[model samples]
Target: MPKITYITFDETQYDVEAKEGATVMETAIKNGVPGIEAECGGACSCATCHVYVDEAWAEKTGEPGAMEEDMLDFAQDADERSRLSCQIKVTDELDGLVVRIPESQA
Candidate 1:
């Protein structure tokens, strides 16, 4: 299991033990973490599950694909670090992944 930390707009942190192969949005939703709406149900068609990947983990998480980047245009406060949680897969390599939920979703 990977340990994922979700930081809310107000800086509230929710650390969860995420199952391997599950998307970050799924882990957050299943663990009751606030701020990730995931309205598209991990379909990668919406920005409701937007999150900012910590700079330290950016390279490991990789860049967003064209489709995901397009969807991120709809995300509030989208930036270089912005990523849709639904598009982030969990793995042992991401053991300490940290993401921050934008205030718009808080």
Candidate 2:
């Protein structure tokens, strides 16, 4: 399992172990992390699970797909580092991944 760190707007951090093939949003919800909403259940149809990928882990996580890019238009305070947690698949290379939850989602 990979370890993921989720930081809320107020800087609260929740570190949890993530299954190799699970999405970041799934791991967050399962662990009771208080930032990701995942309202579309990983369908990529909503921006409720918005998060900012830490710069250090950005290349490893890769870029969001076109569909996710479309949905991100609705995310508050989105930027180059913004990503929908539901679209981020977990992998061994993602161990120690860090993501920040925007005030909008926190």
Candidate 3:
């Protein structure tokens, strides 16, 4: 299991150990994190799982795929760091990852 630290715009933070292969949004929902609403379950159709990966951990999470990239155009504040959490497959490399919920999502 890998631990994910989710931080909200208000600076609230929560840490939880997640299933080895579950998406980051799944882990956030399971831990009752304030933001992160996986509206489309683990599907990439919705931008509700939008999150901003901390600059320090950006490379570790990698970039979004074509579908996710296209979907993100509808997000509130799509930026270089914006990502659909449901599209992220968990891995040991993502441990201690810091994801900040944007004000729009919060």
TM-score of each: 0.98, 0.98, 0.95
Which portions of model 2 miss their true places by more than 4 Å? none
| Tens-digit lDDT string for candidate 3 (28-60) | 998899778878897888798899988998898
Where does model 1 exceed 4 Å of error? none
Model 2 TM-score, all chains together: 0.98
lDDT of each: 0.95, 0.94, 0.88
Query: Any idea what lDDT model 1 has?
Result: 0.95
What's the ranking of the predictions by TM-score, best on top? 1, 2, 3
lDDT of 2 by residue, 1-106 (tens): 7999999989999999999999999999999999788888989998999999999999998998999999999999999999999989999999999999999876
- Tell me which of candidates 1 and 3 scores higher on lDDT: 1
Give the CA lDDT, 0 to 100, for residue 24 in model 2.
Answer: 95
Clashing pairs in 3: none
- lDDT winner: 1
Candidate 2: worst-modelled 10 consecutive residues by lDDT: 33-42
lDDT of 1 by residue, 1-106 (tens): 7899999999999999999999999999999999999998999998999999999999999999999999998998899999999999999999999999999997
Ranking by lDDT: 1, 2, 3
